[model samples]
Target: MFVLTMYVMLLTLDDYKPTYQDRLATPGMMIRPKGNALEISYNSEDTESWDLYVQALDNFLAPYNESQQIMNNKDCTPNTYFIQEDAGEIRNNPKRSCQFNRTVLGNCSGINDRYYGYPDGQPCVLIKLNRVIGMLPGKDDQSPYVTCGAKVNYSQPLVAVKFLNVTYNADINVECKINSLAIANPTSDRDKFAGRVSFKLRINKN
Candidate 1:
């Protein structure tokens, strides 16, 4: 049985100190990690509605409910998102709010910048797909049979790129689906095998 799991964690370039770029460390400025750590698990019998990434989103930002729910949570998406929904909110709240006058979220001027851990609102993230313990779906037939990145856009963020394709994908938005990916159910949503690939997201400052 081949199972795929993904890590969803938050880190600053100075704190996490990953072996690669810090892109995979955070999904977006709005989304936070559960206990500052999270992951997505899947196999073949999952459903599209049962999105793995969405589930992770809930877990990651579970502690910061007040603002996370209001500004970033899908449930609160229906209503208007105020830059000051929780202006005075601190510690487990949206770190970015013009009303709050907080630089904890970094520099809003960098918003949309191709850098992670930046206060820029561009929502850049880093991903480190660890080596799968077992054989991947479509892997080489040699000793080092490993896995690679897969197609999980059905639940991935709005714009995922600089890795395989260019930074283009209108679908990624504030819907909270920006950081999640659809479950990999066999046949129906059988995207990529999470077991084989381990890569860091590429950030192009251009």
Candidate 2:
């Protein structure tokens, strides 16, 4: 009876399918540099301070290069769904995903500007969304976009704070919100960072 029961239970299980799925509707966001705290502090003129950030961005973008996508992934129709059917197994695992080249970032591609605008005081921060299984995001054909706003604006006049006598130093609190028709931005305290991320940026001249 034990041997017969074991054989019957094995037939019901699948190798590729998971028993449970993530119930969360919104995915977490991540940023580059990966500091211990939610702060990005670096000197504008100091190359050593920001070199690690540049290297981290370069390494993360290696797999998204045009050459890499051409060799590994297939080119699918733009602004359309890519439905791939699982064919019979072969010697090599062929391409099943659509091509996503780093060139899509244009100036932020890090091709022409290898430093990623770090030396020029305009630092580039890369944001990534966590992957979810069997998740079809966005309502229409339009893609998702990220929008960021700053708590303090230097362009506008401020009566509370003055920088007339201060040296070259800037500290700004910024928040980035990810917008999508399918994704939900909860207002509750527990789910405050559901589809958004906040970080402090500090740049010093010394």
Candidate 3:
């Protein structure tokens, strides 16, 4: 029996710094901001279904939740923001809210009367892996062969919120990296193999 091992490394924005333009160049990834929403896309060569990709994205953002239910660990389901592809619109799910302040004035006297906005007002950016292509078996005649492997890294971009009062501002960003892939079929005598590919994302704020 032949054994094939695959290793994936997890990285945050702190590991490496990359410009916004560089991160956008990565394959199978797209980041765009609409009138009031952010859209992130991920493409891959794996055969994983769309549902699986959504699950993976959910897992990736699990730690950023600030809901009371989640903090209590009471089996509370966190909120997920959804974006409609056709209309290019964003809607907050039952657990989440997509509200933002629209008015910002230069004078402090006019805006200082209201209470400070909570950090929760910021919309959570969601990432969805879309499609995968160009995957093939390895060329080696060995009984067990490695298909392919690759690594990608990028910094996370920050979404800024300017307060309508007190000139206060808050910025949030997340960095992501993906690596590792291995495919093998043991019963086949034809010596078939496959290769692996990877992608990384990075975002920054000025």
Using all chains and alpha carbons, the TM-scores for the candidates as numbered come to: 0.18, 0.75, 0.19
Off by over 4 Å in 3: 1-27, 31-119, 134-168, 182-206
Tens-place lDDT per residue, model 1, 1-206, is: 12322222233222312335432221222222111223212221234322443344334324334554356443322123423333363433433422221112222112223132221213322222332222132323221121224222111111122123323222221212222222132211132222221222222331
Please list the C-alpha lDDT of all candidates, in the order they appear: 0.26, 0.63, 0.25
Ranking by lDDT: 2, 1, 3
Give the winner by TM-score.
2
Best of the candidates, lDDT: 2
Model 2 scores a C-alpha lDDT of 0.63
lDDT of 3 by residue, 1-206 (tens): 12222222223222322222321212232222211233222222222312343344334433434453245333422233223233344422223323222122111111332211122121222222222222221234222121211111111111121222221132323332222222332222231111112222222112
Global lDDT of model 3: 0.25
Give the C-alpha miss distance for residue 1 in model 2, angstroms: 17
